[model samples]
Target chain A: MKAPGYIFAEALRNLIKKRATVLYPYREVEKIHLPDGFRGKIEFDRPKCIGCQMCFRVCPAKAIEIIEDERGKRPIFLIYRCIYCGQCAEVCPTKAITLGKVFENVALRKEELEVR
Target chain B: MSFEIPIGPQHPIHVEPLMLKLKVEGELIVDVDIDVSYIHRGIEKALELRSYPQGLFLAERICGICNCAHSLCYCLNIEQLLGKEAPPRAKYLRVIVEELSRVHSHLLWLGHYFHTLGFETLFMYFWRDRERVMDMLELMTGNRVTTSYNVIGGVRRDITPEIDSKLRRMIEHLRERMKYYEAAIRSEPSLLGRLQGVGLLKPEDAIRLGTVGPHLRASGVKHDVRLDDPYSGHEEIPFNVITYDTCDCYGRVMVRIGEVFESLDMIAYALDHLPSGEYRLKMPPFFKAPVGESLSRVEAPRGELIHYSISDGGTNPFRYRVRTPTLANLASVAAMLKSRGDYEVYIADVPAILGGIDPCICCTARVIITDEGKKTRRITTLTELERYARERGVRM
Candidate 1:
């Protein structure tokens, strides 16, 4: 017959084994990186944007607005309310609203953050 | 036939209004049903309607207690869409505010819990302690609960030397209080008597039901969202993850009681190693989100708050969804309630139970009332009781 002592030892091993609550992400956070198709911060191609107001109409939070220019269309943006959900870039026929890898930092004043 | 009593639709117990329909057989609760959803902001639906930058601000408004968490996660989702990151200095500021908010929230819950326990003296003491933490928050973010102090690139405000000193002092006072709690738990047999093994949720049940925050940690599980998903330079910050083995109400208190100290150590770490830089970066309100989807999780005062957003390459999100921690913890409450077969004994020390899981009722999506027939009771408020006491010629 198999040894009863071995069964007890196995039970002890399983109890501790089932209780491993340690998150291993700490050891590998450095190795992790976003895949190629990942999207993030919004970037604008000023030349391609036609000031059509399509992006503004498509904006859910009304964060997008048009600027007044003597010669052509204006592009304006407010940073304070932006959630960066990435809807503007996809709807742009000219691909003016592209997602860039630029991360903005905090500002002292609200007006300083508005980009046009 | 015994009647049922509905105690909500407008009640003082929860941060949000939750209606509780209790079937009672002569003051004994026979059956209970819960109904929520009075304040459903439809954040997910709203997310589908706004631009990326606008979504961040609105997301923060979802819960006043953890506005920073919702804002942080929303920013991360945008960053994921834009494929960018926040600078190191901004990251440190985020961590500082995050820990500060944790302290403020826990202090508030602690005070409320004491009020429920009929220990008004303890409640006053805890709230007095909370004022110190709130001072730190106001100094840093200009507002206490609605701290709209973060942006996509980094944090909106910076901490100066004076503010940092105030923070250190607050943490110092809190350390003394935390030590007292430890002593109280050790000596006050009544505390342990009421808490120990009162709501025993086996370890397996905790994990299976997806409990988060102190509720899960109380079960001897050391899972913290900051540790699991290190955002805002959390990977670099050094702090201990506290856990308990009791898996009962006492276990929950013990875990939270230990967290007060942990927050202090983290504040010290963040302050000493404070990164030097510009506080906020520039991101426009009319920014475009790339065509993508992302999910971000933050360790809020309650537990892990998860936000998921899908963008269709426009200024607005196609969908925005949030999974609050309390929602997850609610799943396990029935398990504990049924274990004792008595809500009166289990919930008699109301404040202690209320503080167990940090609740922000404002964000709950659904509240259901389960009862066979309609019944009603005119519950008297404390305000009314005091009036009665004075009129009856009773002297205190």
Candidate 2:
């Protein structure tokens, strides 16, 4: 019911427009600004942590584990298992654990994912 | 003589794993059997073992594309059990994100549908615009694909002014693009020829076979959960319900595209009238829900997604059930594919018919493990399924 030229013209118009594809890995891109409440990797502060195990109990993924050291008990985060829902960070009384904006946690070794 | 052509337990046409056994005489399909037992993660049973907060993650992961709907439905279900209502501001925010996800989901489906039909340019264009929606989701909820935004009480994050401005800009850009798309679809003779009068489903049959969402609407049945059962600030926001009476593949495509415009309008309204208050309530992490059961339904991108849960005064659910939209539409697919009387279906129309429902096979096929060697079927619980995988040293 319609002319064929119009369809081709419509398809060709996008060519003149700016490309929407992002140049990743090959080129340096613009910095991504995460919002204030962005839930990312769990960052635990050893000094502020009271070893109360609140983060451990509230964690959905069970990614946090508290271990006893000479000073006191400290938590280690298994990054791979963490769903990054920010429950641990929210439950932390002293704000020892927080969801940092560093979402690119890719590593070659499995041990690299474990953070203190 | 008729021949059986098995399309898939795996196929490139559909992104998800679905087995379609088609019985054909020449090029015409005579009969069809859809096997959706391949992808079962035991999510419902797994939900029964985890606590309420933990279960939210599992629920969201059920369907990657419609995670927002799953989490929202789960939150609404739990909130009903707790007898707690989210604040006004939170309700508006929920609507904003829910509609944004709907935009992204519909765009994704539209692109994929065209790609299946060999129109790669439109596919590329749709996906490119979809990225803008994904960026908005990442900006608002922190994650792109699976935005774990909805919590038990309300949304996880609040909307900031900066994000609001960006959202308005993106919506405006998409409006222009969608208009062009609408025009293109209307004029393209080849596209119309491929789609029109293919895979017909009558209105009575759609209701009889339990079709939901756009699939039902495509057949001239006016039904939508947002209209029927208003939830998450849907009552305040007004939008038109789109339906096409052609009852064919073209109608399905037209209905979805029309709904995208409707979603855009709703998102703009929600953003303009954004309320001020706490986005989430301070609920205890571990608390036993009172003995009761609640059913919650959300209009997912695919269709109506229902979540039912029973709590026996325990931290974990006693039983959890999920009825995905694709399961409801599968019977209708069988009816359409079968060659009866004047309706003749060819094997070439398989992609159009399957994609018409916008099938999410992963969500639909979450049960029934058959062992052909033993000639028996064993329904394994999540724990037992885990052990079975472990014994075989299989990484799922």
Candidate 3:
């Protein structure tokens, strides 16, 4: 059991410690050092692609679509539906798709989210 | 005559969409009716349409806070169906994240519960500390809230040394804060006045109503899925099941607080004793499961979350059922809220009672909007829904 003034003493101690609240936008926050193996937006290495369809098959979100354009059969990534689970990256036989560190893929248009 | 005091399909006390019809005679609550049909996403049906891997994602989304539990249960269910287990190291990793999530959840609840009881200072303090847990989660799983870390075979990624060190530091920080909180909660007269002996739930009543998790534990029932039915190497890890025999709202708070400490210890143990092996099994991307049925139960932060899946040699499950803890605990709410001759319950105690069980109505409820005036009841099929969506084009 604690006394009534326990909170005040704790608050007084916390006053000296660094504030937990981050002043974002108004102040330039220190850059966050992302750990390795972080799952972010998918980066497709088109040159390494053999069109194995492994990524297309394993994608749980159905975010990856194999588009047969004039440039040959290539997977078109719909970031709008992408969950960033990175199953596509894991299942990619040719190591084509990699989950990059850049997670901020927000945009005005959903079309802008799509990555070929 | 008893008047109805309807507390929302939308209310300030809780964030989720749930309606409570409290029959009151003056300030005393006479009866209670809960409507949990406001926010059903038909996620179970959607899970049936998707493959095993796809279902994992949907399962994780069942409850944002208990995503790890849902995903773990889903994986265990599928693994049982396929007749394989995740590697030992992976099991430890699962325990690590799952327990971390539990800490995050318990802290989140503690903060939210105090807030509901009008303790804004404690709320701010709890939430401020909660950010550290969230940071640990983000560091470990990559995403803070919806951690898509737990995959079917194993986890999505492995933990690095930096993450391990950071997590330990955070756990130490949290341990100190929890100790302070425990002391503060025990001695705080105002908090005790609001919580103690308010919204009493007897042991028999709790068991009868099938109340699982901390709520049941609060009523002095020594039952936890982790202890009773150990999943994902829980048996290998040593931890105590914390329970309080107060049989009231105060007991629930104590139970959760005790759990935070236990979860912290469990995470540390799992990290220290983590085995070195393949995290995930090599399974084909899309494969049909042999005809079988498997049920997996996880001790989620709230309570026992059970997932049952039946597969008939199909890519997708034949039937999938999710029994969230909140749904089970809701039955006891009505019993607790009723004002008996001696055991009285007031309107102001509504939040205290409701918040005690840590209600996650979104996980329990499903919405089916009916057009009564038109007199048309339509059950839209997946194909029809898909066609409608396609015709509308994709809107952001």
Best by lDDT: 2
Q: Which candidate number maximizes DockQ?
A: 2
Give the candidate order by descending TM-score.
Answer: 2, 3, 1
Model 3 DockQ class: medium
The digit string of per-residue lDDT tens for model 1 on B1-396 reads: 667777677756655676666666555545566555667667777777666665666788888878878888888778877888887888888888888888888878777765655556556667777877776776676555667677777776667777777788878888987786566455555456667666667789899999999889999888999898898788898878889998878888778778878888888898899878776666665777788889888898889898887777887887777888988886676555442343343234333444476667777665233344665434354566668779996631
| Residue lDDT tens for model 1, A1-115 | 2322322443465466643222444665444333222344566777787777777765656778787776487667776766554557645779887755444437899877776
CAPRI class assigned to model 2: medium
Candidate 2: tens digits of C-alpha lDDT, residues B157-223: 7887899899999999999999989888888888898899899999999999999999999999999
Better of 1 and 3 by lDDT: 3
- Tell me the spans in candidate 2 whose CA falls farther than 4 Å from its real position: A30-37, B366-373, B376-396
lDDT for model 3 comes to: 0.88
State in Å the error of residue A33, model 3.
Answer: 4.0
- Could you give candidate 3's per-residue lDDT for residues B284-355 as a string of tens digits? 878899998999999999999999999999999998999999989999998999999899999999999999
Question: Alpha-carbon error at A19 in model 3, in Å?
Answer: 2.6
Off by over 4 Å in 3: A1-3, B366-396
lDDT of each: 0.71, 0.89, 0.88
